[model samples]
Target: MRGWGGTGCPGFANLDKAEPLKRGVQCPLANETRVFRISDPETGATCRYAAVPSSHTFSSAQQVCTSCFGGQLASIHNYHTNAEMQFWGGIEIKDTEFWIGGVIDYQNQAVNCHWADGSSWNYAHWQQGYPQHSGHACATFCVTDGLWRSASCAQQMPFVCEF
Candidate 1:
């Protein structure tokens, strides 16, 4: 099994499956550009997310957000923010889950889990009976139930980015 971003997450062994987002030139919105932006009026933090048609490992996704977009992965701090992010991502009730900023510290024996942006881990919407026994867990927001679930960091999936 390969390591995820060389971080020792056994679950991220399938890093080869990860893919980068596609680049292209397309029509822009009238008098403006349409970007996936979600703003929380309460916290005054805005999140910009793009859905990469290609898949990427959790670590790879995080890197792309920081380097390419000048933002870390999107961190869901509260219910409103989570809802807005979901809406911006066009997440549907039956859609598959998408990666977020929450990640388990594999290097630290999975002892700590936190968002990439160092925000308060105050609110979590874990799926009922979650944070599974799965090793080196990474968080994914479920579009189906609008809840968060722990998944293997190695899994290839499109992710969102936030500044």
Candidate 2:
């Protein structure tokens, strides 16, 4: 099934979700790393996102992100981050569908989904009865309903970018 990021606007961001380590900083002990926060640190996303209005095939969209924006498609793992992606598309391309960094794969006749950025697949907000799961398909975000939907890989549409 497709995963939701704001309004179905397809966008991508850099991959590298793991927090980078400082050159000389010692690894923190498990207890030392345990800290409380008002919200998940990933809520705001470490990268920035942009909603491109121009339509493109999925591959083209990805090219644009990597070549022009220096990032790949976005990876959404939380509701808050998904909502943020939606905001960019909704505000800049209201009610438009965009690409996100999601691609469904098949393994042992079962369907699996992942973000192009290679982050953990922990959440999804699919439109009812969606993802069709019949062929090679990609994930898309919709601004009109703010839900995730599946689409053919070659379909031309707007997308989001994170860099």
Give the number of the best model, judged by TM-score. Answer: 2
Please give, for residues 26-113, the per-residue lDDT of candidate 1 as tens digits.
2111122123665667756455554543467888877766544445667877888777766656542223777888976545344467
Off by more than 4 A, model 1? 1-34, 91-95, 105-111
Tell me the tens digit of each residue's lDDT in model 2 across 98-126.
89888987667778898887778899988
RMSD of each: 10.7, 12.6
RMSD in Å for model 2? 12.6
Local distance difference test values of all predictions, in order = 0.61, 0.63
Those runs of model 2 whose alpha carbons end farther than 4 Å from true positions after fitting are 1-45
Question: What TM-score would each prediction reach against the true structure?
Answer: 0.68, 0.69
